[model samples]
Target: MKKQQSQWTHREKSFSAFVTGPLLSFWRQRQERQFVGKEGVVIRYMRMTAAAHKKAILVVPGRSESYIKYPEVVWDLFNCGYDVFVIDHRGQGLSGRLLDDSQLGHVAQFSDYVDDLETLCELELSGSRYHQTFVLAHSMGGAIATLLSQRHPSLFTATALVAPMFGIVLPMPEWVVERILNWTATRPHLREGFAFGTGRWHATPFGINNLTHSRVRYQRNLRFYADQPELQLGGPTTHWVREAIFTGRYIESIAPELHHPVLLLQASEDQVVDNQAQDRFSLARNLAGFPCYGDHPQVMEGARHEILFEKDEIRAEALQKITEYFLTFNPNTV
Candidate 1:
């Protein structure tokens, strides 16, 4: 547990030196602004460790996520001697919001995420003093990273996915529901507007409760949200869900094209995304005609979708596998 030397000003509290302590202090330390893309979308990002390091990792968060949500993970990477860069994707956190006139939280395609990623890699990595670069993506970010790795095979040294939302374990039949929604949306676009899930403005204890393996971590996350109410990005819009289904299906169709060495971290008890699909995809890739694209699959038992936010020991083990794999198979280093 490394003590954070800088006092955080956001929530009027000092952060604990331990890796899994309160998040307000960490969030306060990372409230700086950085520009991304030609439009200067003002993506909020935080960098850990100023000393030039040999390797760097760009962390992408899940849907409707803010950079403040993952300070512990960033700190872990920093302590491991890797310079870390984390950004809030467009329409989330402090990045550019969808136009007021348009549907709130609407992202028409995942390719938009790819564009953002490409800009960050070109602008940040190209100018950085680090020697090697990799991507660690979670959930929706995992899908984006997979697609990006395939499209720009030479850009990243490797990619690590934590509970990648390749597909979801929906309570309802996914294909049937998706087809029905898509069909309904075709006739009257304006009439098709519906909020995703229960469109509640406040964070649900149930949602945050199920996120971590330890009560301490869950409580810490809750306290941060208590201070910064704006950090709570409720549910996805109907349009956003529709877009996600479309993007997810499209990405699934293109998995065979990915050429980078990928490390897929699947949680045994993941509730949000389909664990079975993750395992299936990994095994299918190994059996698929393209042997180069799939080989490394690491499963962390007794973990949830938020694997990095789990108890300290579990999180450490998961990260160790990632670090080891990247260090071993990184194309840029080898």
Candidate 2:
């Protein structure tokens, strides 16, 4: 497929002040709507108006994330002259919860996520005016995006995965944890307990939290959850853990088959996802004895798992690199 004209530009930094300001009023002006996902679950999504001649970028958030948590990122893309679309995945955010306890994170199958994403794209994005589409996914959403990009090779022009959860760091060995969760996931009685007895419904204080090193951004998230308790989600259920393990392994296995232009961003000091697995996935250059395209891997030294929510300097650096990479390939030109 031939590429189209380049619409990328050196947009100035205009979202510098959004992190500390009130975002509800700003986001209320963005278009919001709802759609029925798998099993008729209601999914909430929003879209930002794009400047003329710009493309669309979809934001796929990680576990326990909500669209409410990404106002700064949305504004950043807006400043970069790209229209942004964001969604609250089914198990978290404003979407319908899976279990009786709304705070418990659970999913019967990981494929449900992939199906929901495909549905969302077909219904919401396929008929849009713009032909070039870009994707920026984080953590668990990165895993989902990896599978989506591979399964539907023509869907996106380019993709950037930040702190992707191709493999996760657990206390026990990966196989051991997977076996335990697999056992628990099948039994109806063991599905309600928190995975590893962590990730409660309430927000952890910033003094002891490891999500981000930036106090300002960390406290801002805490305040968001405090004002909107319904958006607060707790630990994952055994089923959720089991599903994630299987999904991560699957994504790793298919990493070499993906055909899209990819930039895999790694957080050098991350304690969440397995960085070794990320390295292996990024290095895959062969499939079925045939040479394949390898991903462009970049490491952000000293950054934590939440690169977008990190310190001002680190976040700025990551976004700058991401913008530069995406500008190299115009979907219309490809």
Candidate 3:
């Protein structure tokens, strides 16, 4: 706790030497569990527990992501001496798919994610005693996690949001996109169909992919989907987009009302979510005399949407910040 975890460098090792070998091995050792989510959906999640641990960290992954994509993250946090929990949100990961087409990502309501998460915590952690509990969420999960914190004022001690999906980076203005989505969201077929230019899951080439600059990490992620097609997740449905947009606005509207502290890390080169919305959330909270951790959204320059899985340097920085922040709430950190 006195010193920060060092940022990993690309010079460290090759793919098989690290990711496929140790990371994969560690990932398989996690306890796999499931519970019935809203509407009979089977929600799955993973947990790494320590007998004498006094702290716990729950990881909330982004849209189109699974706990399978987070072994490295779980390993890192677990080594930091805290229990780690990662959930596969409904409609993605090993969880039950809402739509008939398993690839298409859709949710009945954004709040359902929050509901499932709360239920999971109640079923799993309610009986445990962890002095400091923290939430590390990314993208859409960030929105979900925030809403969870809002509903239960004392569930978590603090939260870390990495490139949260406060708003989607649309081609046109917000009002125009809103009008279009709203008109179609109520329709039966169109509402559940793929939104705009998106479609079923496909492997985006490394060169053209905007997710991460780290070829190693990106390729490893692709390896997961290629090996197990069940893990592949595609674009969001029209209803999903509608829910996300409206929920993002509501999150900003209630930014000042969050009871627990939050650390919002924004990616400078992120092309998925609108940074301006993050700014608005941070500003709103600060103006209300309740600022986010570090007083504003922390911007990680040259980073893409997936900071936790970005290049070594960027990912390391994010991990260090997250580790330090969670440790700050630990009475024995020193």
Candidate 4:
């Protein structure tokens, strides 16, 4: 899709000054639910439905993210005429942890995340045939969504990914990283420990943060962790990192077979996931005649890794594109 003056001008008016009182009210409206995931772990998720029930959007968040940080996003999509659902993966958010230390982000296998999501769809979204369902995934959740879509192609109408983590922007070369991961494999003592340059959950100062430029949104999100310290998540484990790399390559290999259409939104100034990987995925989809991220390079100029929680101007543009893209699947409805 080309950037243009979308009909969703009202969305651009400004929800940046997101108030706590109203956000809290919106949070209260959601139905807190949980289900048994892979290995008998209890995974949590939230559901916020609009009265019309015309359409639905699944909000798949990035690493260290929780539903509590999505009041604004859920509010926007619901107002735009769709119900919203958000899942907390096995090792993060409100879900159960694999390791004893709640701060360590460890998982037995990445497929467990994909399996838990598929189970949720089979259960709570049992009547999903009544309306079209779309996915809004970001960062690590992006990989999980990709796996889910490939496994169940007919489950969702379409998918929109924001800053999807197709690959990680590592601190060192891939060869070196692979060697390090291999070394960890031989040492059980280091396998479950935090990766280099990461540790217990702590707030990064907004001025030097690489996630987003919106200080207000940044500070507001920090408060959520402060108010509920249990929601705080630290770095990833060596096992998790190994799984992520394996899953990412697998997704790229299978991109050409993805049945549903995808709209990927990239952050130009991202210091997180590899942009080149996103491009490769888009190219792979296009090879199979699927419409992927249009006119690459700078999808969102000067934006950081957090596109959904970006400044008003950047976030508004992203929301507009997503609204238009999802509607393309059923143009005559809503």
Candidates in order have lDDT scores of: 0.68, 0.77, 0.88, 0.83
Best by lDDT: 3
In candidate 1, what residue range of length 10 has the lowest lDDT sum?
A: 2-11
lDDT of 4 by residue, 18-80 (tens): 364565677788998999887779899999986677688889998889888988888778877
Model 3, range 1-334, lDDT digits (tens) per residue?
Answer: 4333652545235656877677778877899999998999999999999888778889999998999888888988888888899999999999999989998899999989999999988977776588778899999989999999899978988999999999998878878888989899779798899988899888899999988998888888898999999998888898898899999999999988875889999999999999999999999999988899889999999999999988878888888788878777865753
Candidate 2 on 174-264: residue-level lDDT in tens?
8788778768866787876688857667768887776787777787778878899889899888878877777877877876676677787
Model 1, range 1-334, lDDT digits (tens) per residue? 1132122111122234354355435545653556664345556676665565778899989877777777777866765667788887877766776545322454655677777877777767885477778899999899888778777888887788898987766557877767766765655453234443534345557455556766656766776666876565555555566666666666666666655677888888888877766666676566664432236457788887788777656776777677667767543442
What's the true lDDT of residue 108 in model 1?
53
CA lDDT, candidate 2, residue 315? 80
Question: How many angstroms is residue 133 displaced in model 1 relative to the true structure, after the best TM-score fit?
Answer: 0.6
Q: Tell me how far the alpha carbon of residue 65 in candidate 3 is from the true structure, in angstroms, after superposition.
A: 0.6
Ranked candidates, highest lDDT first: 3, 4, 2, 1
Query: TM-score, each model?
Result: 0.82, 0.89, 0.96, 0.93
lDDT of 1 at 154: 80
Candidate closer to the true structure by lDDT (higher is better), 2 or 3: 3
TM-score preference between candidates 3 and 4, better one: 3
True-vs-predicted CA distance for residue 228, candidate 2, Å: 0.5
Q: Rank the candidates by TM-score, best first.
A: 3, 4, 2, 1
Angstrom error at residue 135, model 3: 0.3
Question: lDDT for model 3, on a 0 to 1 scale?
Answer: 0.88
